[model samples]
Target: MRFVPLVLAALLLIAGQTAAARPPSAVFLNVVAHQDDDLLFLTPDLSQTLKASVTVYVTSGEGSHPESMTPEDYAEMRQAGERNAYATMAGVANRWDRVALRTGTGTTAELATLRARPSVKLVFLRLHDWSDLHGLWNGEVASGGTVLPTGSPARVEDTYTRDKLTKTLTWLMDHFRPTVIRTQNPAPLSGFYAPDPDNPDHTAVARFTNLAAESYEGKAQVRNYRGYDDAQLPTGLDPALRAERTKAFRAYADVDTNVATLFDDTASYLGWRQTMLNRWPSGVSWTDGADEAYAVLGDEVKRWRRNVFGEWGKPVGLGGSGFAPAVTVARQADGRLRLFSLNRNTFDVVTAVQDRFGDYSGWTSLGNPNGPGGDQTGLPAAGTDAQGRLWFFVRNGGGGVSARQQNADGTFGDWQDMHGWGVQDGLSVVSAGGRLQVFATQCSARLYVTATCSIARLVQGESGFEWDTSVVPGAAATAPTAVAGTDGKAHVYFRATGTAAVLMAVDGVVTDLGNPGGPGEVAATATGEVYARNAAHGISARGASGWRAVGGHTEASPAVVGRGVVSIGVDGRLTQLVH
Candidate 1:
């Protein structure tokens, strides 16, 4: 099939061209461990794909029991359910054209394309549910092999190791050349608990998928969806979305007898259908000083300096490259600005210091806390506490927060792990009342599904930091952005679950700040002004009078510097809204 034409057409159509109209060329590659996993966890995102899409099932999904049927029959039944579900999602007839393709790793996998919608394809690796893939990943079993389903067109005689599985997935990605890839969360805080709590096939498949994504040559955007762990979070889906997902899942549940009863258990099934969370949500990094604001524009750092007349000057690039858009800036007591950004290639936290002359030094790398090979760190959050000391905090590889403070003599101290686990990224740090208050969202540790998350606060104490966690009265959809108010209290802002309404919490009181309908990090300024992206992708700010339009489009969250609001425009340039 000619995919280049399709991609070109999609690009043109997305660019609002009126020329030759064609199907979208964008391809989505969704890698899941089980047949129903995609239907349960990846939808409305999976259903929203406009063009060609492919789903790779890494396992046969034949749990410990075959349900009075042979393992092959059970696996085939699951595959058939998936076909029907995909047909339902595509609004087509439940018919497929099945074939066998030999991969570069010498493995023959079954590929099925919807007869009515050829752009939708499915690849079944036919590996056993938990024992083959999960066991191999855990080193409990060294050599595992695939099993051909009952009506499969292929005969798989090859054995698979962890490395071999990763390579095979990479080969598939190379073949499909997807523009976007979706997979399960590799580092889930909780494990699967249905048949066995220790069976983590979803995690294993995600790990392999990430490895494949890293090795793939294409520039595909990768998004990791929370699997079973999403159950513990709030139900963020609207009723219409829940119904749509239920309809698609019901199509699959109708074919598989094992989970067909889930429909009768409305509460349990609704828990899975109502929530679909992304593991690494994008965060906007911004900071400001007395007369200057700094933010990441494109892959470089940019600064907007205030003139003598209090007019903001044009943004100037600081000449650093390969940096992620997320950045944090801390103003020193001596009137210098310190900028921190993640190196896109190495995932290392790099920083540049501004001198009195307003020029920035070259970015110096602060080695990843997880050591040289770890790529699990999130963007760094920087703040200046009492005594003119700079502190940097980042979500570590082990799902906890780690901190490093600047020494008095201009050097940095060793990283100290704060050991706060089950936390999402988008950390907010501010110095309030002569102490540092680090705010983060702490996920629930419940084994079952629930809508529970707390705003975790780490406050500086005389003998180190003390934890004071409070449950968010309302459901929070995104990570919280906090600012120290003039009253010396921390004000937190977050997008509410289900409604997408921006909400604020102060002194344990939660208030609705109106729904902007866009999802991202909410920006709270020190002067009690709140900013969020509206449905049209324009920045909206709330002040003493009410919410007002800021009149600029930004892909990243808005930030405040001095009295001006700054946002990275869609064109990767700085747009400031002066108050």
Candidate 2:
């Protein structure tokens, strides 16, 4: 690690103490080329993780699309616009304090600290635009943000090199040590090396940010969002969310723009020119068109470290193989972790096993449920029965739930159909009350459908698993998460389709717990406490006092181990939380 100067360290420590009495569960650093990149392309995600975030603009918002205003006025207006938009999402007044920070190379940057959430910050580097840096290739490899004098207002201070830019970003990482990093997508190399479909600044800034992350030795979960083309695609937000987004964008445009903006004009500008794109990097797949990434939990073969409380083992490994982005893990009574994943390219079901000592036996393929050339979709779920046998549930190629079990002797059983349709992956099975309960989300209008994709429940008795095909209230969308709480009642949690509120259904009664804004999984300790990952990617548990934001950032659905909850983090590592 790079050494921190005594003065700088003291300042950082003081700032940390004053920012929040308790450290933020996780910090997110968002680096972009100009203003509004995050607001434009990274929605719900940016809003979801704004609790402790920093948005860094590499170039001043000036120099692009010149109008009657002076360069300085345009720049200040853009910054003010961002402040208004961010303040709306953050639920605070538009107030911030400015601080001056210097990179290791002595290059200065402007840091704006939120008045309400001091931990949340904004940094501006004021680099040149894409046009000035275009065609200045160093041996067919073009680089931006490395040098000055090509354009930008900051040119008088110094010219940068790729190495210097990397070093500067490294300085930011050293100071913030973000748990998550968001940047624009870097266009991948193609056979013909086609021109980038996004803004050159977006691509360049992303490349520099990625390289800086690579040079930094510390761990940080990173994701890339689509750039300019995002606005041209379908609006990722629902009507309600789209309206909320319009208000935010309107606030941005009204901030010092002084132009009378009609509601229709603002809405049009947002929908037609600044909407969020639903695509992400392949490893980080989007969920139902939303931007949060997911991984299979409890996959076998990854190493798991014990939690800080030594209550459960931490997960280790990069999760399951293949291009599929989702995975689900189940903990067996024997203290083993069974991971189930889908092969997006091939639709094969993959399984891996992890032993008590944290050793993985590698991944094993179970072949496709529909035989060769089968097309499968959605995520798979796993559970264990009272007999200690593992059960894997998947949305079979035929659009119905299928199941197979591991015999007591550890042998595999033939796949069996769990008939009743309306299945689209996102399966959750739990052994409760001496019976195995299977839950899934069903399309309302399709085969075995309802009005919308509603929650469906099936119970396995001595006669075998049977579906009620009845819709669970408040579970009008996505998958259902079931856990037997400490109260001795089985609870099912689901996001009410349109509202995104997490509704807890127990014994036919459902309570709205507000929107978690992300997919959730259920885990329960032996003591009966229920836990799930909150919208901020932190662990939260339902106790007598209600839901509390526990710490940790995870990308996988949670599984229970003893009294602790464990899930995969964005770094493809395991994170555990125990009371």
Tens-place lDDT digits, model 1, residues 329-373: 777667677888776457688998877787886889887788875
Tens digit of lDDT per residue, candidate 2, span 402-494? 888887666569988887664644676667776678887665322111134566887777777788665365435445777656665557776
**Cα lDDT listed for each candidate:** 0.72, 0.58
Cα RMSD of predicted structure 2: 10.5
Q: Which candidate achieves the best TM-score against the true structure?
A: 1
Please give the distance, in angstroms, between residue 66's alpha carbon in candidate 1 and its true position after superposition.
3.1
Q: Estimate each model's TM-score.
A: 0.73, 0.54
Candidate 1 runs further than 4 Å off: 1-26, 139-142, 190-198, 264-269, 286-380, 394-402, 416-425, 432-435, 449-451, 461-464, 470-475, 484-490, 497-500, 516-520, 523-579
